[model samples]
Target: MSNADEYIRKLSFNFTLSYQMPLLTIGAYQNPIAVAMPAAPLAAAAPALAPGQGDHVFGDVIGTIETALQSIFGGGAGWQTRMQKYNSTLASLWTALTALDLGHGALPPIVNRAGMAEPDEHSHMFGGYSHRFQWQLCELVATGFVAGPTGANIEVRVIGGATKAWRKGVMARFDDLIGHLVDSTALAFYITSPTVIRHAAALVRHSAISLTAAVAYTTGHNGPGKLRVNTVLAQYASLRIAFESILLRLENEGGTRAYNAVDDSWS
Candidate 1:
């Protein structure tokens, strides 16, 4: 073939042009090179109080008990009236401590990171015991008594509630409480019928309790009768100790429940 013929054939083939499929418009970004920004971060879904796997009763039980005992004890007959002021606070402590054992669980605090006010459950509760804890324990202790510091103040919890063991061993110790007239020197040492100090001043101090040493082996003036009150108070102290232990455990257990709830709730 001649050189001019070959050059013309190559030029004809090269004249044809390539075409692009046009930029498919991504949603609303009309420009071909729009480069869509990452969807404006989804408005962050406005944070809500999703329960976390953690303790439901957030406050301290022993701390409150310690607070109460610190305020009372050797303080006189005015003690009960004084403690009445802490009705709400003590009720909270009692509910948190007893709630778990009762299986009611506690009303966990609201955690809405969305900057909202927390919802109140007891907006209109009325009556003597204004708080939930007070109402719950009303039947348990019709006439509340001060717990004496004695013996294993925390051992009864291993077998808790209205079970046979609890009713027989722990609660039975106080079955005689109804008729006994508790005196101003509550938690004070007193003599048993056998003419000897039952929970002598020394024994209470030995048990890490430091009530005012009011009773002597000879006189035992704090109690000439109602010897059962001393026994009941000792049992009550043990029950309190047990409840305190459970409170600490529930703190962690409730948190775990909340976390598991969150995880189970999400994908």
Candidate 2:
């Protein structure tokens, strides 16, 4: 698997373990060290408080653990930034493609200048000499034209000679459409994931912050218990919504025609 996949898997494991740990266990780690020792007389009567009081419960621990995981596996801020860059690129490409006027008309004829004297004949015509106009004819593939062995704009055909063999020209047309879609979708995937990765990081950070605050409160002499934990958990509801929003956006984008066009099974 890829590094990102492995990292995410590890993070998932961490999250699972964090939630599995009992609140009392976590509280025991730092609480006993931080909390003031009760007098001998009251010590016997005072209830033992967990590390984050009740606030660092199963769910709370999971949140903090996820954050730590993100920090370690995601290369801290770099992953987030990378995702942002890709997401922006996808958005920009989408904008450009959508705004462009694919002028509706016949496909321009291919002109031969092999024996021509005056090459200026087709110079002023549509899709003349400029590589720029040629690109418009196949912008979808144009968007994703990668370098080949000879440094030419080349595309790979999964089924060789299928383009010419197909009498209906369906295969070639589909190939062109699919190539364009794939490039566009790739751009979208790159750009959109950053938002999710960043949001996930933020969620983890928020949880950690909440846990730290809870630990502080619990270590205090007059700290409350369950009430404080509930309050902190409630604070994360909105963040959860934000995370969901990113996931939803990804789902929506994945279902788009642009995405389908670029997929391996586009035909």
Candidate 3:
């Protein structure tokens, strides 16, 4: 088999294995769905990475993956640099998704007060039964429908209300960003070998699909539920595992050797 064929096979195998591997936990916030209601504004439990920390991590992952692609599909001068530009964009997209997840989790629970109303002794004057009223109040309070003074206060913040629309906008932008990267990569590979472009394109598509699934599972809920939250976390873990697998394969196969080589017509 040719170099490209061998590379593609390795890529496929790694991706399959990675998909089945255990979920990855990034920092303290392993589960994006489990964002706690902050006493202050909604913020991820893990503080933002210090200044260049995020960039360093993004660079390591994106740089390795792009280098591997360069090895398999030769690109014109500066192609790798051009591809690396998307690293920061990808980081931004991740940040946006995390923020949206946290914001959604922090929304106040919707309480229905009518169900909590009880028909008490006073209700007899209104032609109702006292026992029924007394019983209903106890049930509602017990079930958390009625919050006492010391109970957890639920306030609907203005930001919480706008999260739904904000989420839509974030997802839309994610599509655009990923779409651009795919198109750009395809163009780079097309200049070298049209057939090889298919392999590169497929790799990107798989990665994109994983990430899109993560975003979809996250946005699937406007409010938190146990099952939905778990789904979102699982999807994210899958995405991380997939990328890490690719990076590992690239490193083992000496893909970084192509980083300084320029032999295509992508310019």
Candidate 4:
């Protein structure tokens, strides 16, 4: 098949929204159900596919896979740089996703050795209910380790994009959350993900600071769960997946060359 066809096929594999779920009734129709076929069932989660947009979850890791395969077939100019980002983000995402429980969760019982009153009760997310805001901080694992902005301000807007217009002060809320999270001696997370902790630090300075033409599509997006927002979330997923697919393929093949190539970040 031609390169274009290959890329399309790769991107089309496992598409899914980043995170969202509310029993929203799609305007007035679900794409006019086919008489010849039974209607597709609705997804069991919020951030579900729009009605009739069935289960085809194209993972974002395809670019890496495609490029790695291309190198084997005599193509691919800068696959190494791509590989680092894809792999690290994939790792970072996994770490963040681990704390996936949301809603009315009891804050783990604490025995403060330092003798301090436990902060607010219940282990809940930003709003004390939905996890959508919590999902924004998926990139937190990169702090101190990643070459660019890796704090909470570096969450959803960075992961999703500036295009996603957040609720007023929403971004700042995340920034505060991250600050508290990293600083809190009471709440804690041990970096146990082999996927996240193992990778060497990366330096792709394209976060909230740089805002160059290359990654400058940081406008137009509404907040999560809003109409069309999932599309943008899926796009972010795709970009990271492109890099991860490469790293996974390389590890499987035991190809160690160019493993430490520079991955431009922050700028």
Candidate 5:
């Protein structure tokens, strides 16, 4: 097969495998979910920022409290960096696709080939661009991830192009394409399934409940009905507790271990 054709085929294959494998193996097979624990209320650091005598304190205490809060939550820099990496990868893919002229086979490489070096950046050029053959029209369907500016927003601005052109019949073309691309990229980049923030919250809850149940069952902390509830709680805690029994025996003996559908907090 021609190099451009080969590249597209490979990309498509990669996309499908990345997106489908997780759903089939993890998302489908995994049961129960992890729920996030609510943040504990901050104890009174000192008093208020307002001034006071021997008992009262200055604004410094307030500042300290603020600092602590920032330290706890503001260090998501790693997540941002990983997102940038994903974006950069998408950008590279965009360059390749454009260079290959995937939109149409007949069209020559978008970038001129004259002299200087390289084999179509992947064998996209043919006979030094003297001849061009048009192939099937390539249309990328984007997922919301693109519009949401996921992966450094590369999926949208870099890959989808500054101006997206779709068939006239399509009304929600841009929105639809963005959604597909984002979902696909999230899967491809993180090896995880696409998920809404709500899913994460739900998973966190489920996991906690599952875990608590498991602990209760082992300890015999409740009656039959109460035992059933504890089992559910135990399953929720599976993300932390590795023992499968802790998750299973706790909640109907069928606890689930679900990965966050959203891109990993790291990637």
Candidate 6:
């Protein structure tokens, strides 16, 4: 395999491992609200309480608060469904990306000077002395060409460019999904428990705050919780950087075509 082929394979693998795999666990984390306040079991015997007393008013207030909490946090069913859908989307994306044929074999060599070329100096030196030169002997080997893609090569470039644009769109959707997960998880933590908020406040150095760090602390607070939100976020961060690096490599090095946003076809 050529360098381009190897690089493409490596990038695809990195995206699968770092971006898609970790994303599968984004919804696995236990809802902090559920953990902090579990539903109470029904009492075997009801204590006789006077009407409009302290305990009666207190129970009413608690019941109202629980109802509001349920409304905000949901019952975890819808969240699970959204997660499954995102995971399915990622699986499909992986299949399409892996199936793409971005190999260097399709591209024509930049320098195609095959036939022999007798220099003017040689002709001037030997006017009548006609000397036959081998095709390889007079071949001109050039580094870079100043021409656009043409012929069959254009198809290869179009596929590559389109795939890149499609991947970018998928990435943007992925970001939105992750952001939703993070924000929901963080909100749960903020409302259900003060531990995460206190920890995050302590960690804040200057005026700027890191929500990622807050989520990480919450997930890592009591050992490795059910949700792996921190790992997902970290892996996604690395994946973004790796993706940009892959684009840079394709642009600077020859062989594989770089993304052409102007002429890209999302469909």
lDDT (tens digit, per residue) of candidate 6 on 1-267: 554444434533333333211111122212222322222222222222221211100011112222322222222344223222323443233333333221111321111111222122211211111111111111111011112223111111111121355345434433322222222223233334423222222221111113354455556564322233333333344444443343333233322222222232211
Evaluate model 6: give its lDDT: 0.26
Candidate 1 residues lying further than 4 Å off, grouped into runs, are 1-219, 222-224, 254-267
Candidate 6: TM-score?
Answer: 0.21
Q: List the residue pairs that clash in candidate 3.
A: 118-133, 119-133, 120-130
What is the Å distance of residue 38 in model 1 from its true position? Answer: 49
The residue-by-residue lDDT of candidate 4 on 109-141, one tens digit each, is: 121221222222112221122122222222111
Score candidate 4 by lDDT: 0.23
Worst 10 residues of 2 by lDDT: 199-208
Model 5 scores worst on lDDT over the 10 consecutive residues at 129-138
Tens digits of lDDT, candidate 5, 169-188: 12132122212111111112
**Distance from true location, Cα of 123 in model 5, Å:** 53
Name the Cα RMSD for model 1.
31.5
By TM-score, the best candidate is 2
My TM-score estimates for the predictions, one after another, are 0.20, 0.22, 0.19, 0.20, 0.15, 0.21
lDDT of each: 0.24, 0.24, 0.26, 0.23, 0.21, 0.26
For model 5 the local lDDT of residue 163 reads 18
Q: Which candidate do you rate higher for TM-score, 4 or 5?
A: 4
**Candidate 2 C-alpha lDDT tens digits along 196-225:** 211111111111122334334334423223
After superposition, candidate 6 runs with Cα above 4 Å error:
1-227, 254-267
The per-prediction CA RMSD against the true structure, in angstroms, equals 31.5, 31.1, 28.5, 22.7, 29.0, 32.0
Model 1, position 99: C-alpha lDDT score? 36
Q: Which parts of model 4 are misplaced by more than 4 Å?
A: 2-83, 87-122, 125-130, 136-161, 164-170, 175-267
